[model samples]
Target: MSLPPTFDPVRALSLARETLSIEATAVNAMADRMDDSFARAVALVLGSSGRVVVMGMGKSGHVGRKIAATLASTGTPAMFVHPAEASHGDLGMITAADVVLGISNSGESEELTAILPLIKRMGVPLVALTGRVQSTLGRHAAVVLDASVEKEACPHNLAPTASTTAQLAMGDALAVALLDARGFKADDFARSHPGGALGRKLLTHVSDVMRSGDGVPRVRLDADLMTLMREISAKGLGMSAIVDGEGAVLGVFTDGDLRRLIEKSGSSVDLRALTAREVMHPNPRTVRADALAVEAADLMESNRVTSLLVVDDAGSLTGALNSNDLMRAKVI
Candidate 1:
């Protein structure tokens, strides 16, 4: 659709919508195209003891890399090897135990077509994702997935737009199906992505990030004002955990508590006589050392506290941490 000489935001928006609708239609068409081929491809990857080796070139290579990453991060062990690179002594990466997934919009990339026979000769199962099922790569594949598209989102319809999108969607579908077959969970995903936010939320325990042993600011319940002040100052957490003789956390005394005590006592109050149990906030919020660090962060935020005392199941102090600790660990 062409706009008139006059500028019109509505007309421009309509053209954008038309592009999206065309791509969406392409993806929907692929749903009906799914048949025994997709099933066979899934079975090949799932049953393989080795990895799912994905091969592609150009834009298909970009999509293939992401598909390989998704599959590996999910439950399937997958890797991407460029077809051109594979022909140049990289074919050794594939073995008889592995299954090869080749992606090409036209199914006739000379590089991919050239390597199919070698991969097959090695007794590796070949699965092809292509727009043309009759092309050379498709003809050589044991399983042919029809990743056809009606049109490209590009105005000239020359670029691989909708076709690449279909390939990506189909790859994601296959990965998720294998993930379900293996009963992959959030914890399993986190194991593969330990540095990501989701991994921190699911895998980083309090003990992994909290200050332990002497690093924790702790004082006995019978400790005097001077002792509590020194522990809090030395820890620089603006707080101290008050524990019983057995190391069980009894209460928490923060800078806020000191301010409140000063307000109530005014001048001429005896600081030397004060004890942790007298001014400390008893039964302070606590988290287990083995708990997720994200859980500790949530506890601190909800309680409006800067630090928390880490405890074991037996209610003994094991560690301590403040908001800064969570921030340092990138758990905040």
Candidate 2:
């Protein structure tokens, strides 16, 4: 109401820096506070026959959802259930075989407290990520991981800024530890995220999208200019592969070569007499069918070429693809 104080860059920057420093300090403090409780929680999750059920209220619930996703993507089965909803039939989603991860900044969220007794009666392992060990949620939990921070980043110290940051960090630590314990690899991650661009880059093979089985523009080494142009036009790849009788790639011919040859010879050379091997670029850039599609893309960009010939270990032409194929495959 009082004109919002005068706008000052120095004061605004100081506040921003202070907030970051406070949150960073909270995360580091959580790291130092890691004890046997964190290890116990990890082991319980890893050994559980059922999924991890994560529950919280308010801002804690938001953090719990992200934690569940991280666990699911990193080789652990997990799901988030709202504490308030758990009391109204959502508890059916839980089972005796599951491990329950409860989050409460004060360790006294009433909605969580209502279901703690039931989880105990069912003999399910309870892992609590909380700020107060003496509070109700802490006492009921079998293992308690402290998520306390020195203070909130908010000037009034009333919001959940630093506290939520610590919770997220601890959640990430749990997921990463579980990932290593399970020997989760990049291929496993790619399988879980097949629709993403990174998944395409990692999972797509050179053979999956290449033009093969007569689609590749192949011609004999001694083919004439008409034969070379016909092969390129028929395949629609802007280039042709010159191969031997055994299908071994001897050289490659492209539109650029045609232009250069015509310019150098003053457009007077006999087209029918020009052979493929005489004008083709030998030892062209090639990739194996088993290699990752991203590697092929990297090669194309580095060499400034639009297409690559896919060959086998024996250097025989098997397939071919251009930039458009990579774009359609989402590897571009």
Error of 1 at 70 (Å): 1.6
TM-score of each: 0.90, 0.91
lDDT of all predictions, in order shown?
Answer: 0.90, 0.93
Candidate achieving the largest TM-score: 2
Candidate 1 residue 181 Cα shift, in angstroms, is: 1.1
How far in Å is the alpha carbon of 263 misplaced in model 2?
A: 4.0
In candidate 1, what are the lDDT values of residues 1-332, reduced to their tens digit?
A: 97568878987799789888988999999998788878888888888999999989999999999999999999898999988988888987888999888999999898998988898789998989999999998899899999999889888999888999999999999998899989999999999999899998899999889899899899998899999999999988899999988998889999998988899898888978999888888898999988899999989889888899989888898898999989888988
Predicted structure with the largest lDDT when compared to the true one: 2
TM-score of 2: 0.91
List the candidate 2 regions with Cα displacement exceeding 4 Å: 1-9, 301-304, 312-316
In model 1, what lDDT does residue 106 have? 92
Give residue 291's error in model 2 in angstroms: 2.3
